[model samples]
Target: METDSPTIPKRTLADLLFILFLRLVAVSCFWFGLQYWAMLVGYSLVGAGRFDLLSLPWKVASTSLAVLFPVASLGLWLTVSWGPVIWVLAAGGQVLMYGLLPDIFGPNKLIILLHLMVAAVYCIFRLLLWLEKRRHRRQVSVDLP
Candidate 1:
């Protein structure tokens, strides 16, 4: 006679992908925050003239980003559903700031790229969460005895 023990479901590809994406976003946010902090401190000490291209306006922008990104990233990592929305807003704001106020903030090709990348990851993660929830509902419906 053979006895069967319950087995846990293995992690799906989607789960792995979502986890990897989350890690990537977390790391990106950490690095971006560090850069902003450094810029804020450096600008305060050396004056905007030392980095004329990235003047006072750019310093202000960096300080704002440093304050916000870490909060958004932490919220997301803690599995708060609002995290994605915050990230989206931050990214959108940055894009608009870069496009509409280039003169004051200066042009930054890298920032545009970073915003696009973060947006893509946020969308993907949200989709994955939706699918997982749907799957869970279906399982409950079917398992009802």
Candidate 2:
């Protein structure tokens, strides 16, 4: 009964959506990484040797995120287990710090708002995925005997 063709694992709609979500996450990570890099380089060039280049806490946080972004991007792109962990560390740090001290980030409210929007959308996606799984399970159970 064996055929020459290899079998592919069946993927449910949730799996497909998850893969798409991961891809989008990786893309956003890369985008933010670039933004961080640009800000650092631009500031460094504009104010070389300046002691107050960035406030000490902001400097430390931004540097940490700048370093973590590439590794996270690769991890996310590959769907590695730690990829999301790294992304959360970076993004969460920014969100937490900005929430604690909005002035340090900027006068503009857009950054904080964008972060909240992304978090909200992610929560919604997770909810949808859970509902999909629950519905599928119920259908399968109903069909059996």
Candidate 3:
């Protein structure tokens, strides 16, 4: 006999891939957060990376990222709605740091490129999922007639 609980819908391959991607990004976020914390706490391999020695700009960017990345990591790992939102904020922070103020925060072309690529992939997956859902709805409506 079936229980009163509603059945959970199965995740499609696209959904699985999206989740995998998010988890991978979450791992990277965790690493970045760790690095920031290390720098702030004077555990960085390079002495120059330490927070106390850093100038105002570096301190601001590092502290903000140190806080944001891990929170984004948690959200991303869970694959909740807030995950992507936080990720966007964190990534956008990096973009602004490197892209808009390269002199203050050294230019990081690689980071920018990777963020763009990941964002593009996420958008593509979302579009594909929306299309699949729309097609399924049409099919279901036709079958009902």
Clash count per candidate: 0, 0, 0
- The per-model lDDT (C-alpha) reads 0.68, 0.73, 0.88
lDDT preference between candidates 2 and 3, better one: 3
Model 1 lowest lDDT segment of ten: 1-10
Indicate the residue-level lDDT of 144 in model 1: 83
Collision pairs in model 1: none
CA displacement after TM-score superposition, residue 129 of candidate 2 (Å): 1.3
> Which candidate has the highest lDDT of all?
3
- lDDT score, candidate 1, position 54: 65
* TM-scores for the candidates: 0.69, 0.69, 0.90
Which clashing pairs does model 2 show? Answer: none
Among residues 3 or more apart in sequence or in different chains, the pairs in candidate 3 whose N, CA or C atoms overlap within 3 Å are none
lDDT of 3 by residue, 1-145 (tens): 5554335545779889989999999999999999999988888867768888989988988999999999999999998989888888889989999999999888999999988988998899899989988887798688985
lDDT of 3: 0.88
Top of the candidates by TM-score: 3
